[model samples]
Target chain A: MSVAMPPGSAFLPLSVSLRGARLVYDDLLLFDGLDLELVGGSLTCLLGPSGIGKSSLLRLLAGLAPRGMSGHLHDGSGQSLRHQVAYMAQQDLLLPWLSVLDNVLLGSRLRGEPPDRSRALDLLARVGLTEVAHSRPAALSGGMRQRAALARTLMEQRPLVLMDEPFSGLDALTRLRLQDLAAELLAGCTVLLVTHDPLEALRLGEHILVMNGRPATLSALPELPGAPPRDPGDPALQAAYRAILRQLDAGSR
Target chain B: MKARLWRALLTLAGLLLVWQGVVMLGDLPPYIMPDPLAVGVRLWRDAGLLLGHAAVTALEIVLGMLLGTVLGVLSALALGYSRRARRWLLPVLIASQAVPVFALAPLLVLWLGYGMGSKIAMAMLVIYFPVTANFYDGLRHTPGGWLDLARVMAPEGRRWAVLWHIAIPAALPAFGSGLRVAAAVAPIGAVLGEWVGASAGLGYLMLQANSRMQIDLLFAALLVLAVLAVGLYFLVDAGLRRLLPWHPANPATLENG
Candidate 1:
């Protein structure tokens, strides 16, 4: 799926159509009759409280969702999209024994290519970890480790990038920096990020899908303004945040 | 230097005092509990011959340990890195452990004869389980993010890349644990094999000394065996510390270490 980079904000031409999807785990129904659509090449931030199945939705979209879950998805231009989508889990699970560069080059290793060391190095440079390319994950701080994990994710070059709480453990400063970096990089890819922070949703998401309640069906898809790389502190950003918070509050009551 | 010497002397003195008290209190004959001085003198007198046999047993332990490492890693890789192999062989491997080493030792001796070969085989039987378990656990426990990163970075047939880049490296901790256990147990297997049926080793020496009522020589042989086990353990432990320098336990002194 070739995602045409949207001007001003990175947009991927996504027309993801899911109809009557259902997921269950050990007799506990996670969702049923779940229908959702993702706009092409758009930054969609999925937000919900814990146990709302937001992460589960991202897993379904990535086709890595667990067994016994069934769903159908269509790409942009009303075409059936069946391609390898990259998945980033909630934890920065870098192999502790490998250096930052080696970890990033692992994608190439798995596919049987002489790991393109230069490309891995460049991507690590992009994440500001060029000097520590030879450093093992155990030697890195939490933020650095997560950054290394992000670089490893980027090495895949997949069209669809799915992130589940990628910024959950970062401090405010590092989280903001990573959010901007993620937005800049995804300028050419389809990104479906599951997050809990409203401000993050406003700052990075072009479209926001709020999930809530039992079996956690899609609550709503609200539009955000100023187009990402939007200013995190812009008045328009605050306005979007305020709107999402109100909806969440109303839903909880 | 002085403090260490003082500590050493104190420890020696305490050990001797305890030995004398136990011997006296138990009303044991000299054959049952030789004085520490008598054992030391006997060990010094037999040092040359005892050292030669100790070297032979030590060689068997080392060779068997190396063999076990190769076998354990290869089997672990075959079982852990492949689904088909794991499905077919994993059960057999687990079931194989139920065959006790003592039960197998005689069979190995029967097959290999009463030589260094038999001793090495016995040691191999003892060393295999820990190494296999540790390596397998380590290989399987590679972080999910690392695998995902590998998929993204290489997206090509860098499967070996995952092996070198992730699997082996991730498995090092568990591998180290296994090696430590194997090192400690290697000498035991050698001694046991000697005990069963062997000549020119510490186990043989112990039996000969005991039959002759050479209690001092028996204690000396036992002492040498303890030293071999401890020395092998320390060497392996130091190597692990060197490899995993970043591990918290490596940087700081562990109570056991």
Candidate 2:
């Protein structure tokens, strides 16, 4: 089931622009002078080999300062994008002590705001986790925990969402199902998803960027035909999967 | 559960047998070593007296734990929430542990007087370190991912909310460990204070019985103190397990039977 958009304010779909971004750690440059733009209301998949700075780029955009990283991240209106962005990492990062429903409302509670319990339940129901809403995170399966995390990310009602391998730990079938769910739920928001799986990029990315080299640069791949939650078996998707593999392999040297 | 109870009973019986064997084989007099049965009889005969002293010691232990835990938790929060507080208080927290608390028993008794006040103070001093150290470590090491999520979710000015909602709850299992250690060792401080100078408590009774050569009564008091320590530890352990239902106990360590 598709998630209902949160009430009161519709998302403004903020477009993010990163210009002349430089990241250095321990005198080793990870990326320098990187320019990237995330078009509003589209899903962008970032694929790169291990330690290639894709997550660092995503973190930079999310306004999380990686030490020694210099960057300018702003929406087009000269305002900061930090308040409009929500982040989801590989680990679900759910508080084991909190009930699943409580975990969904963690953002509100942390912000010292009165939680919208009804909207939280609506998000949970859309994720098909209504039954386990009252259970602790430890009691849920891996897939279920990630679903709850997805619900939590949506609960922020942000215009831009950044996810770093959010489904990498799950089994194959669960990952596919979550990709479809996330696509439906995050239909109109700007999403930058960092993933290792090529097929996942094919299935969900409207625009795919492959990051390569020592001081990494993002090279945009040819846009996939049609919208996301695309059929994995489609000939176009299979062709794109091979192209991504080749691009990643060429960069590994 | 039944199997575990039976195993514990058997272990106690085995230890009693060893005690009885040692007494009989040494042909020791009551002054030197009383049999377990003799101590048991003394325990029955002096039940009221023993209970009175036991009640005093128990009060000191419980109150000390309450005060120590509260102080430790507050200190941990202060250290975690403010960088300035951490810089100033951390050295003092470390130095508090550097000086052996046992060395201060006489000083505590002198300062607080030869009453329950000194004993409770001693108990609180004994437990304060472990509760503070373990909890502070836990707070310092809250999983980075959770903190990152909190940063994005909450506003920058509301950093304390992250510490309260995320870091504090995450640190509870460690705090529980500290509390368990506190319960086990809290009796030591109370008894040590009583040993140095006190008119009441099991420690005082034991000292009196020792002076009079009432070795069996001394043995009875010792046994009661042992029971008190064990009982208090288990109580804290059980309460902690109940409080942190989410902290999974190791199945291998759990009493499955």
DockQ of each: 0.34, 0.81
Instruction: Tell me the TM-score of each prediction against the true structure.
Output: 0.85, 0.97
lDDT of 1: 0.79
Supply the DockQ value of model 1.
0.34
lDDT of 1 by residue, A171-229 (tens): 99988888887787666567788999888877888888888666766765556556786
Mind giving the per-residue lDDT tens digits that candidate 2 earns over B79-119?
A: 98889999999999998788999999989888999999999
**Stretches of candidate 2 exceeding 4 Å from the true structure:** A2-9, B250-257
TM-score of chain A of 1: 0.87
Q: What are the per-residue Cα lDDT tens digits for candidate 1 across B182-257? A: 9989898989998888878898899999999999999999989988998899899988988887554553346436
